[model samples]
Target: MTSTAPAAGAATSGATSTGTSTATSSSLSTTINPTFRAPTPRHSSFTLSTISLCGQPEDVLDLQRGSYALWRDRVEMKLAIYQVLDHVISDVANPADPEWLSLDFIIKGWIYDLITPELRTAVSSPGATARTIWVAIETLFRNNGLARAMMLSDEFRNTKQLENPLSVYIGKLKAISDEHRDLGYPLETHALLLQLVCGLHERHETIGKYIQTEAATLDLLRLRGGQALHG
Candidate 1:
């Protein structure tokens, strides 16, 4: 009976030890593995919208040397490509729209970069919107007096071939003619062709003479000749 009692007590002790070991493991697991999860970071404040517009337009708006018409067309085309033409054309602004206003300022910076220093000062005003600056530029160029037209005409008549290519010389004349035409004095087509023929380099004498002789029916394509000569 005494041996049997010791065996029974030994069995109870073993069972109690096993139960205590299981309880300790379960308590450690619960304490190590928590149910609460931390939040993920959003980074909303650090985020910024970006645009891909870089570099100045080829035709910078300098009235003394650059073509306004060409500059205006190029600027508009670039803005159209990036889908931001509305910023320069539309006067309406929604102050609540942060994205729209952000793009507007970006475009304004682009224009400021692409114009001449003289023009920059002329168009710049305190608190001017992009549209306002655009309109001011248009007014400055398109609303000058008769003296501007006269000066342009003089420049047109005196534009010589110099060391430039035939196409480049013609392009210069055409730009002047375009500005002149804008000011209500369109150069006659024949006169423009004559000016083009007269401004050719001495090396192109043969083609120049041919063009002069055929001036009556001279197609514009004749000026856009062999790539070698045009270049």
Candidate 2:
């Protein structure tokens, strides 16, 4: 009768087969060892290139020449920066990205530096200075419809004053507006004047209300044959 039990050689072969399976499993365990864990969430630093101020020379010369083209160029540059920042905010995943927001604030500060002194003189002297020409530029900013366009951008919507560098310039704008009112200027300049006031004070409802009240005094002058028709 043939024995069902394995012989000595067969038993030895079975033990070797079991030992080989254990070695293969141990090799896989070594090969699959963890290298590094996942990174934790943290703030990342970023950088942005500065915006160019094109057409500045032409605008400066035109200012001296009393040419509308110079004023137009200046207004265009201001609006262009505003528009570009607005687009950047929309394209980026994070609306509050610090680098992008800082660049926007820098551009705005440059514009304020370029215009505030001129604005101050114009508000003080009414119709008797180069600052009066600046009023036309301000009108271009508003009438071109870029101001409202900026307000529509995610940058404007998501912007927080505490995190924004532009907050300082905005405060400067409010100070300028307050100073203008104390200078006794009439409301005919309100459209341009209030546009600036509103641009800077948009975050403060009280300042906006004050601008509205101050702007209410503007009266249109009638012209007859290039001569003032209304007193």
Candidate 3:
């Protein structure tokens, strides 16, 4: 005689021996283009509040772990920021509005200030694993877009020092792109690849101040795409 048992991969329909119930199983579907929803605006001091709770250096590690988990789980936050910025740069309709560009700059400035130099040094150190580098690259890309915007803005011309990290960040971005390529992943994983390449090319002349390249302007043009560059 055959015993009554749920088939493999199927959930029990009713009460179990332990007075527990099971829900029916369904096939799981996966997709590359996950649907992204916008996140609701949180209190502007949310990051600060989280940091404040971590009162000491030892607590900072725990805070970072918790923060990383939150960032990873909150798809809406990533979508509203990085996904929206990606569309803006690609000139997608509705998503490419200039107002969003301004908001991006403002948000980036806040984020950049929040990332202390100590944090940057820690993230970029030789001990940093691939996952650490990936997270840092994501943070930099989200902020570097605003740096590029500031570099192009007339008001920022008077405040050149504020724009210094744009090139340094690009270098780090290129390094991350190279790492992704070496790992045999598609270039799309390095979401800011196109922007980094273009930004490097556009600022090749001035970038020498930050990164001393022996290659001349003509050589730099040849190295990158051989065309007039625009920031």
Candidate 4:
């Protein structure tokens, strides 16, 4: 009762302290800031390094003999590149398109791996298109034409089926035969059949004996063999 109403100065001081606290809180809420970061940029032209291709081009068996080695290596590389570019082979509309650029990049990566340093320098040129590179490779390798074809033919002829099925052996023979035909030398259907028969592994000797008779058709040979196996 003695001090309750007499402390006006103390009441004023308490009011000032509360007001200062409120103002400090308001100042912090208004003045605090947030930071922002910028996004990363991307490259314009499609670019890739050489590690993508699994292996170097297979050397032509004749590489040790003479100039034919160059052709064989290039042909081997061409086949590999064809496989790599199989999807885009049909996409031939615009060279300036991004898809084309991507194809060019892939061709480069595989090519870089396929070629040795010497060949790379020989073929490298500024602003070279993919088609140009293809042409250059073909031109370089096609030098020893008939000799290369003969080598492929010899390999095809000697390709006897050791332990594989007729289908597998025939498939291998067919690939060699196709390349053989591309070089302007073709075997008759009967000749191919004979090769098929002669190359069979000893397990299929019964089927071989059946097909060895005169006037045997490839269709009939497969039919009789399948029936014999299943029956």
Number of the top-ranking candidate, with lDDT as the measure: 1
Model 4 C-alpha RMSD to native = 14.1
Ranking by TM-score: 1, 4, 2, 3
In model 4, where is the ten-residue run with the lowest total lDDT?
60-69
Candidate 1 stretches greater than 4 Å from native:
1-58, 219-221, 226-231
- My TM-score estimates for the predictions, one after another, are 0.67, 0.22, 0.20, 0.48
Across 1-231, the per-residue lDDT of candidate 3 in tens digits comes to 865465532434334522331222211222233664456654332342233222333223221221332333342254344333332233233326555444444433333333445555545645333234436645654444434333323221222323445545444444434433333332452234334433444445464333333223322222234232332
lDDT of 2 at 109: 41
Residue 89, candidate 2: Cα error in Å is 14
Return the candidate ranking by lDDT, descending: 1, 4, 2, 3
Alpha-carbon deviation at 134 in model 4, angstroms: 0.9
C-alpha lDDT values of all predictions: 0.74, 0.42, 0.37, 0.58
lDDT of 2 at 169: 41
User: Regarding TM-score, does 3 or 4 come out ahead?
Assistant: 4
Candidate 2 deviation (Cα RMSD): 21.1
Model 3 CA deviation exceeding 4 Å by range:
1-67, 74-98, 113-116, 120-231
Model 4, stretches more than 4 Å misplaced? 1-106, 114-122, 125-127, 214-216, 219-231
Q: Measured by TM-score, how close is model 1 to the native structure?
A: 0.67
Q: Would you list the clashing residue pairs of candidate 2?
A: 187-218
Model 3 RMSD in angstroms: 19.3
lDDT of 2 by residue, 75-166 (tens): 55555544443322233333377654455444444444455455434333432222233444455434533333333232323323343433
Q: What is candidate 4's lDDT per residue for 1-231, written digit by digit as tens?
A: 377654787888788888998999877766663443344443223433333544334532232123333444554565454444432234353557776577676665555455566556666688766555655555655654577668876776798988766667767777666655655566666777677677788888887776676335454234434653355
